[model samples]
Target: MRKKAVRNQLWVPIIAMTLLIAGCGTKTEPMVDTAAGSKQQQSASPAPAPQTPVETVELTISAAASLTDALKEIQTVYQTKATSTKLNFNFGASGALQQQIEQGAPADLFLSAATKNMKTLVDNQLIDAGKQKNLLTNELVVVVPVDSKVSIGSEADLSKPEVLHVAIGIPESVPAGSYAKEALTYGKLWDSLQSRMVQGKDVRQVLQYIETGNADAGFVYKTDALTSNKVKIAFAVDPKSYQAVEYPIGIVKSTKHGKEAEDFYNYLQSKEALDVFVKFGFTVPK
Candidate 1:
């Protein structure tokens, strides 16, 4: 009886230990699973805060007719770098462009062919005067149709009898016209050529007249003359005869893309854009 009781006690302890081991073993996987689940929930439910969407800005630029090509080329480079920006350009006579801006056209940038127009904007506080920079300079040239046999050697050649029709931008509004008048007056031919002159609203219109053979000769920027393969350059007027054609660029005061606009204005003075302007017959302004 004593032996049997001792044997029974040993088996009781063994059975209790076995039950404890089994209980621990059965809970191990569930504990691990619960820990893993908690980690997953923490990772999956990160934060309720919303992320900001990338912004897109539209910048409107009112520029002189002469900068149409250069601006277009520059826009390509700008767009490639600033993928979220959209550049829209309105090219016209400097005076007209100023009028548009003054009349509440949504312009982020203003580029004038002459300082006179830029001054008009500055006087009205439409642009940030402090940000304005003189970017380029240009010279006036006389252009005739490629097939025209009109012999033109100098400003003196403009007064010939065969040069019946001459196209010029309206002197009051167009910077090119202002430059043309300055050249003609300095050469003492303004009065003589007045009778044969056809006035266009803008310099581009004058170019159109010559390109369509509507005029025997026309006065335009050297850059414009270089742009057309059909028009032959008769002569480049002496820079001394005309007021310097300096192009000034500035950011509009009310621009929505204020930061981006200034960035692009800075880019204009970059070597990449400057080299392109030089290739198209424009000189860097001093």
Candidate 2:
């Protein structure tokens, strides 16, 4: 009886231990790592900030035809500095240019060969008179074909019989022509040569006439005369005969890119641009 009781106790203890081991072996859910899970959730990408786009502004400059060569050089140098702005030039007679601006042409600035054109715009309120600057001075000269037989010493030489087609810019619109007329009138040679005159649209056109031999003699700015190898300056008209040939530049009142236009305006008046002007045979005023 004692051995049987001992065997029954041993069997009960062994069965209880086996059941505990099996319960441990049964499937169960693993503990969750809350800290690691929160870290993963926070590591998700954050919303990005909105960025403003930089825009390139195009500034339109209405300049006199005589300024072409200098401004072209200036354009090259300016692009290096103002990478954000693009320059667009509209070159013509100063009077014609101001008239266009008055009629709402798409111009940001007006660079006139003479002050009269600028005055028209100022009186009309298209440009602020106070903002204008007398940027340059020029001399009117008589030019002839490099290979011409004409002997021009002064305004009197233009009246010679061989000088048939004397080209001058249209006096009403072209500042160069106005200066020429004023100079010739002062010399008392205008009335006598009116029949032989071939009026051009601008000083450049007059230069072209002389270059192509369409005109025997023509009046042009000294700067224009230097641009062509086909024409030679005959003589410089007396500066005292006419109002000082001054170039005035001003910002248009209706510019959409006001800030950019002002920047370019300030650049033109800088030493770098003035150097280019001097290189092109233009005299920059102090």
Candidate 3:
């Protein structure tokens, strides 16, 4: 009986140990599965998305100095509407700008005060011929200092001995000067006014000369004369006396911003831009 009791005790401890091992093994498997599920959930989560980039472009425009006032206002309106594109303007004599473009200057668009300058670019195929158009027209006039007593009533007065110095733009380059030459030649005053002439680089310079009293009288675009408070219109040249003064604009052929340049170019021909030009004393061409 003692041996049997001892054997029974041994069997009881063995069975209890086996039950404990089985419980621990089952719990461990569930714990491992739970940890694996958490890892799987973490691996299935999506990453953040990338952001979209903004579109932006810059265009450089070479325009005539005469268009300065109107363009300044137009630029403000354009920026308000076209927030992605920026306009950079280069204002100067149309002839000079043409030379710069011919020399490979980085210009996207060209606005000339006269068709002759535009022709130079077209002849060389520097501008997109199809995109070229006459945009505006202007009148030529004689002006004098506000305080001057000179009786410069007409184009003929420019020849009078009393008018010691008459300012005119250089005929070889300036459109205003070319107009002045045409009018003087047509009126039979070119030869007579030679000794009394003070040639200027551009129309604005002629206006300046008259305003500062450096010249007794000067010939300039009506628009340019209007900009100075110190100068007054003496007379308006008859339209028939000179070739029609037309302003033309075109896209430069080498421009990289073709779409943006075309957009701005078309915008300049819009009614809103035309209104601004007219307000600044420019006559929109038909």
lDDT of 3 at 164: 95
Model 1 alpha-carbon drift over 4 Å, by segment:
1-52
The lDDT of model 2 is: 0.92
Clashing pairs in 1: none
Error of 2 at 281 (Å): 0.9
| Candidate number that wins on TM-score, 1 or 3 | 1
Residue-level lDDT of model 1, residues 181-217, one tens digit each, is 9999999999988899999888888998999999999
Instruction: Name the best candidate (by TM-score).
Output: 2
Better of 1 and 2 by TM-score: 2
Question: 75-97 in candidate 2: lDDT tens per residue?
Answer: 98898888889899999999898
lDDT of 1: 0.90
Off by over 4 Å in 3: 1-55
Candidate 1, residue 71: the lDDT equals 83
What TM-score does each of the candidates earn?
Answer: 0.82, 0.83, 0.81
RMSD of each: 5.6, 5.6, 6.5
